[model samples]
Target: MPSVFSALPGAVLDDSGLLHLGSPLVEQRRLAAGEAIAPLGDRAVIAVPGEDRLSWLDSLTSQALTRLDPGVGTELLVLDPQGHVEHAASVVDDGETAWLITDRGDAEGLLAWLRKMRFRLRVDPRAADDEFAVVGGTRSALARVVPATPAGRPLVWIDPWPDVSPGGYGYAAVDPHPGADRDWAEAIVTRDEERRIADAAAAGDLVLAGLTAVDALRVAAWRPRWTTDVDERALPHELDWMRTAVHLDKGCYRGQETVAKVHNLGHPPRRLVALQLDGSDSVLPVHGAAVRVGDESVGTVTSAALHYEEGPIALAIVRRSVAVDAVLTVDTSDGVISAAQEVVVPPDAGRTANIPRMPRLSRRASAQ
Candidate 1:
């Protein structure tokens, strides 16, 4: 646990072992209004230094980041050889160092992999967990409380969810997307600054929120996270992650062939969906709860939350063959409850666009 969260009153920890406000409703309201900040206990930071840091990362990840400008917010994914998401991170580079904000559980492994691949490069990858803590809020909200970074920049990674970033693609066919207004940002804060913020919150100068509030909002926005929503069989397309994490035309890297093939000629085996769980019992199903269509098991719930406005909501990954209209049931310890499916990544997800080509005159006609 981060020392800063110790100052919070009536804080309850979640399954991720992170502290959150006991009053979820109040926290949710504060968060929605951009008046709260949450200690991102599940997140950690990785520092990449030396001259070739940016170019080396660009050569390895899913995003095109070779020319990334200082203080720019972008994200990238380390993909498996089969194009499955191995790891994902929110990134921002100060003039001298590139900071990666990743799930805490992934930081050590990601650091080791980067070290293995840096045989002769100028990149030095290291975990900075001891020196930095991650705090999350909306960009506008975070602007009011400045955090200090090792590189002296206000190190913030702005989320670009629910939109088609440059060199990315959008597969969901919807206007006024739910996540269009997700202004989430994670700031790397020094321990002293964290304590100062905590003291302010403790003294009634600032409001504090918990992970429950954050996750609930993320569910409502149909945002996919690396830790909860991913399994061994997960594909980027299933989560509609191509909207930001993938660059379709970037130079070859690991899994590029599989990513290209699936986009152009194949469909992902599974798809992500948002579910409105039956709230009659007021019980939220735990993560990994089984989702079934009648007697047959169809999918598994990745994350479940009680939103301020949406009641009980969840994100589930089900087979692409599952009918969109199916009324599913989630098996919880309390009992089975009905699940109404809302399409996120639809069944026919990987169709390639037919780009029109310009007509070229024949050589014989040109000669004539």
Candidate 2:
């Protein structure tokens, strides 16, 4: 199938001021391969205020939130008691409050879960408005478009230029087209969706992409999306999500014991490895397809795609015991698909190597 992520789509503004970024779902029907298919922006934000924000979040996530700077953003994970991830997202703060942007479908449910676990803490938890928006394109077009939100929360509202981002419920001042009115091209998915954007870009509104384009972009960026690279039962160390999400020394969270245990000494549970699938007829493996070393099932394919840049690629959760040169087969209904495993990290960095005991963290080191 042709990949939609390969090229940007087209749209035009009518004389009446309506801008049309041709609906990918409506016009194209089936999404093109690799298209970023979602309406616009997967970026999510959660706000935490009051005095206990840092400690509260530090206890909830796998990262050391205390060290995270106000302006910078880092990825972190919320793990279930069993050590599986409950939610995954970027953690950003601005001194007063902390913002968490997570996977789309899981945000609300995860927020509800966090609320249930809020035992006697001064910190409040909830999904921040999804109203966050992104403006991508030429700088000349957005020169006049100043960000219109207060500090802490990003400057979301786009001024001077036009073209509202897709999703629900937000208005912006945009040029939608050559001379389109700012209001005419505006879109609203839900009230929350509009609040998710940080600043405005000049690209205007691109069409809503299907799942296809998103997969391609994922491979190109080596961005490990949820479920694809992680399993709830798996430890955070296995997948190396610490860069953005897991705070290396954030105090005790729900699964902090396991995270700390895995980080200091014992090897991680499993490793998330990228794959290059072989053959034209061999389709990308579906989630849960058994990956084999000869006949033994060593892992399962969590996410796969026929990428525009890389013909076929996937993310798989494989046992740490699997050999470095392991050649695995994905057992799909159609047939077996062959792929080579390429390990991104090993136990030393984050992946666990079954050899030593859990290491201890110094109080100073655990501050974050």
Instruction: Give each model's whole-structure lDDT.
Output: 0.82, 0.51
Cα displacement (Å) at residue 318, model 2: 1.3
Per-residue lDDT over 40-76 for candidate 2, one digit per residue giving the tens place of the 0 to 100 score: 2444456666577777677777766666566554556
Candidate 2: which stretches are off by over 4 Å? 1-44, 119-121, 129-211, 347-368
The TM-scores of all predictions, comma-separated, are 0.92, 0.64
- lDDT per residue as tens, model 1, 175-269: 55667666788889887777787888888898888888888889888888888998887888889888898999989988888888988899888
**Residue 326 in candidate 2, Cα distance off native in Å:** 2.1
Q: What is the lDDT of candidate 2?
A: 0.51
Name the best candidate (by lDDT): 1
- C-alpha root-mean-square deviation, each candidate: 9.6, 13.8
TM accuracy, model 2? 0.64
